[model samples]
Target: MEKKPAGSSLSKALTMLNHVCTSPVPLRFAELVDLSELPKATAHRQLNTLLEHGLVRFDEHKQAYYPGYGLLALAHRTWANLDIRDVAAAPMRDLWSSTQETIHLAVLDDAEVIYIDKLESPKSLRLYSAVGKKGPVYCTGVGKAILAYLPEAKQQDIIHQQNFIRHTEHTLTTPQALEGNLQQIKDTGISLDLEEHEIGIKCVAAPIFNARHQVVAAISVTAPAFRTDDASYETMKGLVKSAADDISKRLGACD
Candidate 1:
């Protein structure tokens, strides 16, 4: 075996790790060697380096390599320091421009959604939701958007935490009703407030996913119910979903 420069070896190892992580299933050493297109000995050497550093782990029972907990810890650190508002700014502006509706970006906190960013519409009538304000996950578009995509266990936990306050006549006031609405949102990939959070205010929203395809946030386009006719509502739904998709892609979400 010939010695490779440290930089070259490190690059190859990182590239191999990318392949491993992107794979839909755990890979055996032989599969990784073929997938990486690296010399068998070089691949072996890189795998050992990755395992030694805790970046990768070999599953003894399955005889395959999987992402290690060390990588998960690193991912958690990366997400903790990430600013979702920064990732969503461009798309939010574009959505506001297209729909002439207020744009909001929010993330789940406990059982609620906290507004992290807001772009006001140019129109005289716009949603007055302030950044940093929190709203119930069961009644708001952005909140439901995030809640709908959560795992069933987590979703139930959050649902139980809701006070089930009837902020408006349209609000889903029961766990069963909210769960049904969430199922529809998850199926259609969109959520509608329909004046549920506040009288006269309505919105369309979509979930934003991270690299792991987990729902990390949501984006919305809000307007007064009077102006959100069926046609405009349909348009805003697409715009909000598209904006969410763009932001999700920026955060490294895959199809």
Candidate 2:
């Protein structure tokens, strides 16, 4: 490796991180020393600094260093500030006005769907869902919408993680049942939560795709089943799908 020129402290740390990431396997301290072209003492010192900050972790078993959970937290914080949320805001408001129902924007976290934003319903009926709260992906409209579009392996992994402790009588408590629902969502570009997560509560949801056509988040309109029969549910489905499409487009989604 060529000698790296002198640079800012932050720059050097980033370079070290990049070096470790480029390796196909976790790197030993000596390997990192060679790959970063830094003196052994300097490499050791810098790696310690990174370790303290949780940017890197040393595995006692493997005797190697790898990325740490702190970086994952930082990435999540960055995702929170992404322009996609801002882009979806106006569209969410417009959809709420048109439907006169509570709306939500959510992102998938591991095995749950985390509500990132919500616009409450104007009618007297209130729901328990609130921003930052998490619910199962196997039982909620927004949850299933995003789950259906996830890469197959990741989807299955999340399904495995689910406890399947039923929240309602209608909840899909088994993998086989949930798989069928997800397949329907993929085919229709819409997902329905038919009083599955909350009794007498239902929602219509659609997946939001990013520029690469990857499902990143979901939008949903939720209301009581008593207020919306199947006919009204169909109308809500169109509105929700349209709103989702608009947000996806603004996020640079092509299709």
Candidate 3:
């Protein structure tokens, strides 16, 4: 076999790691050599480096290579910091500017949504919400947006956890009710909080996806219900969804 020259050490390492991480099943040594297109000696050396660094593990029984806990640790750190806030910065600003409404970036934590980033409205009247505050997944726009896109089993788990506290008259206080609403949001790729989380507040939200097309976060544009009429909500919906899509793309989501 004509051996292809391995690129820079970093590139070679990344190429091997990517394959290991992306493979649905463990890869044998021969399979990796063929997949990476590196000479056997080169591949062996690179595999040794990866193993030493805890990037991959070799199964002695199966004679295959698989991702290691090191990758999981790194992923935990990345998710803990949640670079989505930085990726959504510009788009969130644009959405806020377009709607002149309060903007929120939230990620699902267990059954609740944690407000990780917030852009206050330029207007005098803004809803009461702050970064690090937790909100219910069943009643808040950002929360519902994320919950709606989650896997069915996860959605059920979170839904089961909700206390169904009615914050306002509009709040859905039953699992059946919330489930129907989530189904609508899942179909539309949008969510709305019609004074469900807080009285006199309303918002439009959309889910943000990661590279694997999983819903990792959400964004919302909120305003006083008195000022947000049907027509205004229509406009805000488009802006919020567009901004979420932009942020998701920045995060490497294909759709």
Candidate 4:
């Protein structure tokens, strides 16, 4: 039997890693084989390589594979290196004080939205998500807002790379529908969560541009459903947009 090419083996390993990272829970070898579309022997070899590299680990009790400490270490380093968190701090605080809602700053990473900063509202009933949490780009307001302004090729690449898993009944699961929504967000300069990612959380988000006028991040205000009636939603939308615009301007985005 001929040995597979190095590129082919590397591709299989990456596919397996991607499968483990995307899943909400650990995956069994069978699951990895099905998702990666690789032969059982190939999958085992790739998984073993990943395990040796500390990119994957197996749970003995459950007999499932999960992302290993290597990924978490890399993620931590990446987050620390990004200056967006420092740049967003003052504005996030202002937004939090003004809207009295949870404020979040998120950036697009590997086709997902990763929260880098957050300011919790003082109110007892506020929505509570944390920094470093990852959310689907098609469902969360911050994700959609940034995605709306991304380059067409990058957007299409992300759409093609991942399966649109519906987190809730309201989640947009089809590529066409997501594209339509992105168009609307680009036109309006605002995006809405609408309880798509979480049942009771509603968020209004807008894009944050950089010195080159390219959108590099998004800022959002999230509140519970009970506090976000039609009128309040509109108010929060305007506030979130204004805050995002101010931050963009601070970063030298104009027009």
Best-matching candidate per lDDT: 3
Clashing pairs in 2: none
User: TM-scores across all candidates?
Assistant: 0.73, 0.68, 0.70, 0.66
Off by over 4 Å in 3: 1-82
Clashing pairs in 1: none
Q: Top TM-score: which candidate number?
A: 1
Cα lDDT, all candidates: 0.88, 0.89, 0.90, 0.86
- Candidate 4 residues 1-255, lDDT tens each? 433434567787998899998999889999888878787888898999999988899999999998999876776676447587777778888888888888889999898889988888888754436788887898899999999998999999987765788888999999999999999999999999998988988989999997667889999998889888899888888888888988887776777
* lDDT by residue for model 1 (143-214), tens: 999999999999999999988999878989999999999889989999999989889998899999998899
User: What digit string (tens of lDDT, one per residue) describes model 3 on residues 1-255?
Assistant: 758874898888789888999999999989988898988888899999999989899999999999988887786676557677788999999998898889999999988999999998878875667999898999999999999999999999999999999788999999999999999998898999998988899989999998678999999998998888889889998899899999988776785
TM-score of 1: 0.73
lDDT over C-alpha atoms for residue 125 of model 4:
59
- The alpha-carbon lDDT assigned to residue 38 of candidate 3 equals 85
Q: TM-score for model 3?
A: 0.70
Backbone clashes in model 1? 0
